[model samples]
Target chain A: MTTSKQSAPISFERERPAGKSAARYILGRRLSRVWLYTLLIVTGLAFGLPFFWTISSSLKSITEIYIFPPTMWPAEIRWKNYADVFTIAPFARFIWNTVIVTLLAMLGQILSAAVVAFGFTRFRFPGRESLFVLVLSTIMLPWQVTIVPQFLLFRYLGWINTYWPLIIPSYFGGGAFYIFLLRQFFLTIPKDLDEAAKLDGASNFRIFWNIVLPLSKAALATVAIFSFIGHWNEFFAPLIYLNSTDKFTISIGLRYFVSNPFESDEPREAILMAASLITALPVLILFFVAQKYFVQGIVTTGLKG
Target chain B: MAAATGRSWWHSSAQRREALEGYLWISPWVIGFLLFALGPMIASLYLSFTEYKIGGSPVWLGLENYIRAFSQDKLFWPSLNRTAYFAIATVGLGTVGSLLAAILLNQNARGRNFFRALYYLPSLTPVVALAILWQWLLQPQVGFVNYALYQMGIDGPGWLTSRQWAVPSLILISLWAGIGGGRMIIFLAGLQGVPQELYESAELDGASTLQRFFNITLPMISPVILFNVILGVIGSFSVFALAYVATDGGPNYATYFFVLHLYYNAFSYFQMGYASALAWVFFLIIFILSFVQIKFSDRWVYYEFS
Candidate 1:
C-alpha cells in the first residue's frame, strides 16, 4: 500500500506549512515513522523467533537438549543429528515419497485445471453457466462431509495403504478454487489469437496446446506452485490412506517417531526437531521462491475456504 | 445456437457439435464429481441410517444412529461443546488480532515487503511440524516458555499435560501459527481497496483518527471482515491435525474435538454408522450457520456500490 519508501503513516500525510509550526509538524511525522518502524520490527522478530528456535534446537546434541535453561544456540552444532534422523527412521524414503506425491499431484492439477478452465473460458454450450456455478458452489462444502464414503470407495477399490488415493483425485481438476483461478486467468487471454488459429483449421486441442498454453505460463505456474505446497503439507489424506511404515510420508514418519513407545524417560527432542525441520523445509523454500505467485493466487481467487 | 425442434439425434449440427465438444472438455470434472463428491455423499447419507461396521453389510436400522447420538452417547455432546468453544475463541480472537496486524502493516513505513513475508512464514509451516515443534517448545520443565517463566520467579503451568490448560494452549499455538496468515493478507487487500480520498476528506473535517477509522474504514471493510470470519469458523471447527498430534485428545479428553471423536468412532472402533451420523450433523450445522450469517450480514456489511 505504501507508494514510496519515505512516505509516512496516513495520519501524517498532510501538507507541510511554511510557517514556524512547520518544524513541529515535521517532528511529529518523524516520531510517527519511528513508532511505526519499531512496532513492525518487534512484531517481525516475534514471528521470526520460532523458526530460529527450531533451527537452533535442531543443531543441539541430545545431552544439551534437555538442559534446564534451553540453549538458544548449541555450543557444538550437530551435523550428525541430520544423519541420525535417517538412522532412527527411513526419513530419506519419506522425503522421496513426499516428493513423488507432490509432483504427480501438481502435474495432474495443472493440466486438468487448465483444460477445464479452457472449456469454461472458450466454449459456449447449453447449461455452461449453471455448470460452472455448480463447480463454484462445491467450494463451500467441507471435505469432512465426503471423506468417509470416499475412504470406503477407495477401500473397495483396494487402494488403501497405497499412493493411489492420495494422487488420483488431482487428475480430476484439482479442486474448485484452482479451476476458478485458472478460468479467471484464461479469460484474460485475447480471443483473437485463438480466432486466428481457427482460420488455419487448427483443432480445438491444437489451439489450446499450441496457441493459448504458451501465453498462460504464469497462471499455470501459479496453479503448479499452489498445488505443490498444498499437497506437500497435507497431513490428513496421507495419514489416513498410507498406513504402512514403508509407505510413510514425512508427516507420518515424524508422527511415528514421537508417538512410538520408548523405555527412556525422555524422547529424543533433538532428533524430532531435526526431522521436523526437514519435513517443513521444502514448503518454506517454495514460499520464498514463489512468494509473488502465493500473493497473486490468493488475491485473484478471493475465496480460500 | 441450433433450433431444438429441428435437431435430430445423429445429426451433427454446428451448435450440437460445439456443445458435445464442451462436454468432452469438462468430462474430467464431471467424472470426479460422480466418483468423489456426489456418489460418496449419497453413500455417506445412506450409511448414516444403517448399522454398518467395517467389512459388514449395511443393515436397516432407521433413526437408531441419530437417536443414540442425541440421547445415549455421553462424549458426543461434550465434544461438540468443546469444539464450539475452540471455534468461537479462535474465530473471535483471530479476526481481531489479524485485522489489527493488517492495519499496522498498511502503514507507509519502510521494509514493508520483508516484514510481510516474515510474518507469513508461520502459515507456510506444515501442521505436523508445527504441532511437534510447539509440543517440544511447551515441554513444561524443559520448554522455552517455562524457562522464561522460571527466570521471572514463577512456575509455569503444565500446558499440554494439564486438562485446564489444554484447549487454551492449543488456541495459543494456533494463533501463533495463524495470526499473520491468510486472514492478514486478505485484510491487507481489503485495506488497500479503501479509497484514500475518504480518509483525506475526513481528516480535513477535523475528525480524530479513531473517528475516521470507525466512520469510513470499518464500514468499507465490513464485507471483507464477514468473509474472513466465515472462513475462520469453518477452518477452526474442523481442526483435527493439531490436537491429534499435540495432545492426542488426552489428559481426560480435555481437547477432544468433534472431528477427533468422529474419527475415533469410524476408524478406531469401526463405528462407521455412528461416525457417518456425526458427519451429517456436522455438515448441517455448518450449512445452517453459514446460511444464517449470509442472511444477516446485510445488517452490518453493506457494499459500497453493488
Candidate 2:
C-alpha cells in the first residue's frame, strides 16, 4: 500500500511546458505547491503534537508536570512510574479483566456478526431488506439511551458484577456496525461458489463456516480489531455494570488515580499517565498490526453503518 | 386445473422452504435484536413514565418526569443548552478542519501516506489516554498551551475551570481527538468518486484550480458532506467520556453534556425515570435534526447512482 503511492509517478512531471503562458503557469504552480506543503506540515503537527505530549508527560515526574513552561522532554526519565501505577491502583487485575472481556467480546463479535452478515449478504433471505434495516436502526440509537433499561435487566439477572453483561451481548450480535462492515465484504464474494456448495449438498451453515469464513480474512480481522479496541476502551458499561472493585476493567480502574472523588489521595500524575499508557498499549499494538484492514473497513463502510 | 388451483394458507413447497431457510439463517440477529437491543429500548421507554429507583417498585406516573424536567428542574435546560452549544461549535469546526486536512492529505505529493497515518495516530490513541493528556496540556496555570501563550504576551483563560470556556475548551479537545476517521474517511470516499474528466475539462476551459475545486469537487461530494454532518451531530450530542474525564462537567456546571447529565441523574441522583425521559428527548432531538439535514440535502447532494 505504501510502496504503490510512494513509487507512483508524480502527477506534476507530465504537465511540463505548455504552448501558452508557460512561465506564468510554472510560477503559479510553484506558489500553489508551497502553500500546499505549508498547510500539510501545520496540520500534521496539530494531529501529531498531542501524541508527542502524551509520551513526554507519561515520562515526567508529577512535580515536573506542574512546573511552569512544562518540559517538552523530562530531564530524567522515571521508568519507576510504571511501578508506581500498579502500587497506586489494581493495575494488574484491571489488565487481566480487560483482556478477558476484550477477547470474549472480539470472539463473540466475529462469530455472531459474521454469521448474520453472511445470511444477509450470501443467502436469498425473506424479509432480508426489512430486517437489515432493523439491524441498521440499532446503530442510530445511542448507547446512553439504553443504559437504564440494560442496567435494570442486568440487575434482574444478577449479572451486574459479572462479565456476562459485557461479554454476552457480543455473542448475540454485538455491533450493527461490524455486521454492516462484514456484510460489505461478504457481498463481494462470488455467488457461484455458494451454488457449487449447494450442488455438493453442503448446508448454508456448513458453507458459511468452511468457505465464507476462510475467505473473509480481512473483514474478520477488521471486526476483531475494532471489537477489541471498543471493549478495551469501554468505560461506561463497565462503570455501570461491574460493582466490585476487583471486577473493574482497565478503563474504570484508571479513573482511581486522578478522578475518583471517593479516594481522597492527591492526584498522582505520574501514576495516572503510566496507567493511561498501559491501558492504551494493547489497542495501539492491535491497530498497527491490522491497520490496513481497519483503513479498508472505514473507507468502505459508513461511520458506524 | 393447475392454473385454477387455490393455494393453501401454509404452502409447503421449495419456495416456502427457501424462505424458511432465510429466516433460519437470520434468526440469531433477529433474536438478539429483540432480546438485547430492542428490549432495552422499549423498557427504557416504559420506565420513563414510571418512577423506578433501585430496590423499589416502579410507580406509574404519566409524564411526571418530563413535566419536572421542564417545569421544576433548573439544571436541565442550561445543561441541554450547553450541550447544544458544544455540539454545534465542535462539529462545525471539527468537520471543516478535518475535511480540509483530508483534502490536503489526498493530494498526490511526497510523503502523503506517512502524513495520512500520522494524522490518524491521534484517533487510534485511546480516548482515556488522550483525555488525560489534554487535561495536562490545558491545565490553566503551568500547562504548555498557556505557557506558550504567556510567552506570546497573551494570557490564556482558565480552560476547563471557567464555566464560560469549559464547553469551548472541550469542543477544541474533541475536535483534536475526533478528527481522524469520520471526515477523513468520507472525504477519501468523495475524492475517489470525483471524476478525473471534470478536472481535465475544467483545465481545458482555462479555469483555475480553486475555481475547479469549488465548481466540481464541492458539488460532487455534497452527499458525503451531508452524511458526515448528520453522523457528526448525532455523535457530538452523545459525547460523554471526554467531558466526563476532563472536567466532570466543570468548575461551574459548564461542560455537562446531555449524556453526562443523564449519567448523573440516573446513577448519582438515582433519578432513573428522569434520566430515561432525558434520553428519549435526546433521541428525538437527534432524529429531528438529522431528518431536517437529510431533507435539505436532497436539493444539493448529487448522487450519481440515482
Q: Best candidate per lDDT, number?
A: 1
Q: DockQ (Cα-based) per candidate?
A: 0.39, 0.38
Please provide, for model 1 over B1-306, each residue's C-alpha lDDT reduced to its tens digit, 9 standing for 90 to 100: 335733563255876788789888998998998898888778889999998888989997899999999999999999999999999998999899888778777665556778888988888888999999998878888988888789999999999999999999999888888888878887777776666667667667886666667787789778778888887888888989999999999779999999999888888888888888999988888888888888999899867655
* Interface DockQ of candidate 2: 0.38
In the range A174-272, model 1's lDDT, one tens digit per residue, is 789899878877777889988998998999999999988998887788889889888888888998898899899888888998888545655588888
TM-score per model for chain B alone? 0.94, 0.93
C-alpha displacement of A72 in model 1, angstroms?
A: 1.7
lDDT of 2 by residue, A174-208 (tens): 57888888887787788899899999999888889
Q: Write the per-residue lDDT of candidate 2 for residues B96-126, one digit (tens) a residue.
A: 8777777776655578767877777777666
Candidate 1, residue B60: Cα displacement in angstroms equals: 1.2
Ten residues in sequence with the least summed lDDT for candidate 1 chain B: B1-10
Estimate the lDDT of model 1: 0.82
- Candidate 1's displacement at residue A198, Å, is 0.8
Index of the highest-DockQ prediction:
1
Runs in model 2 with CA error above 4 Å?
A1-31, A260-267, A303-305, B1-12
